[model samples]
Target: MNQSFPKAEKLKSKKHIERLFAEGKSISKFPLRLVYLKTGLPEETRIQAAVSASKRNFKKAVDRNRIKRLLREAYRLNKYRITEETDASYAFMILYLGREIPEYEKIDHKMKQLLALFLEKETGKKI
Candidate 1:
């Protein structure tokens, strides 16, 4: 599979996002929190993802943007772990919950663990 995160893999629909927030299950690994919901979609496009940073934590747009960027990059690099056989597609929103700026290595490490946990939670089977 391609490593790039294309637009088709993005969670942009307002209705879908609202449903995700309303009904999704969440798992947090320190600085990162993932809210995810599963629905029926094509196999090739089984996952749609979004990243968020709270305005209350980071007052400046630049700060929020930076955190989101890092979160997206980490997820992009490690998202392949989510490619298990399943009957439903997943929509995910990753929230950065750090009080201060974090290193990319830290985020990457945590993101890998987070993705594994997500797979386990969603599938009810170990990956």
Candidate 2:
């Protein structure tokens, strides 16, 4: 797996983001919520993703940025779980649900579990 989050795979469209929140399905694991929408994507793109940390929870810009970074890193490393097995393309937003700063280990573990839950729910098969 490339494991690098390239610009091509980053979710940047305002319209798409709105549609995603309106129509997307979600899987939640504490401190993380995976909101995913089934949709057409550019060729060779299985998923385009974005990460967010709520400003209300983390008032400091530094804290929010760090949380977003961790979310993105966790997703970037483990995204192969969704990319390899499924044919349909998706738009994904991984939201940080915690009020406090999170450790990398905790985020990584929850990310793996969350992705596994997503795969099972969408693919109808055990991982």
Candidate 3:
């Protein structure tokens, strides 16, 4: 209900991150790919997310950080699409796969698509 990306919403635990990569289901939407797994965390912390921009593609840290900022902003704004009342919690790692920097509009559109796709898969209910 806060609608803010606080520390609780960030996917930061080492064990969770490792488990997500090892056992998560993945989906790609152009520049963004999401790896997500259901977690044992409580409903209040239902969804925890991490964003990554590949170091190999973005040689400069600034560039990578900028891309990650965009990704996080987009997800922050649109997370409600996938945040329904449910018993399951999810951990998500969003990987940026673009060769070039992307604009906010493009990232926003794709983020919506990604969330919608995730919801569809999760509930077999279309939004």
Best by TM-score: 2
Best by lDDT: 2
Q: lDDT by residue for model 1 over 10-60, one digit each (tens)?
A: 999999999999999999999999999887767789899999999988999
* Model 2 regions more than 4 Å off: none
For model 3, name the residue pairs that clash.
none
Order of candidates by TM-score, top first? 2, 3, 1
Q: Comparing candidate 1 with candidate 2, which one achieves the higher TM-score?
A: 2
Q: Write down the lDDT of every candidate, Cα atoms only.
A: 0.88, 0.93, 0.90
Superposition TM-score, candidate 1 onto the true structure: 0.92
Candidate 2 C-alpha error for residue 105, in Å: 0.5
Task: Give each model's clash number.
Answer: 0, 0, 0
User: In candidate 3, where is summed lDDT lowest over 10 consecutive residues?
Assistant: 79-88
Q: Weakest 10 consecutive residues, lDDT, candidate 2? A: 38-47
36-117 per-residue lDDT for model 3 (tens digits): 9998887678899999999999999999999999999999999877776345789999999999999999999999898888
**Could you tell which candidate, 2 or 3, scores higher by lDDT?**
2
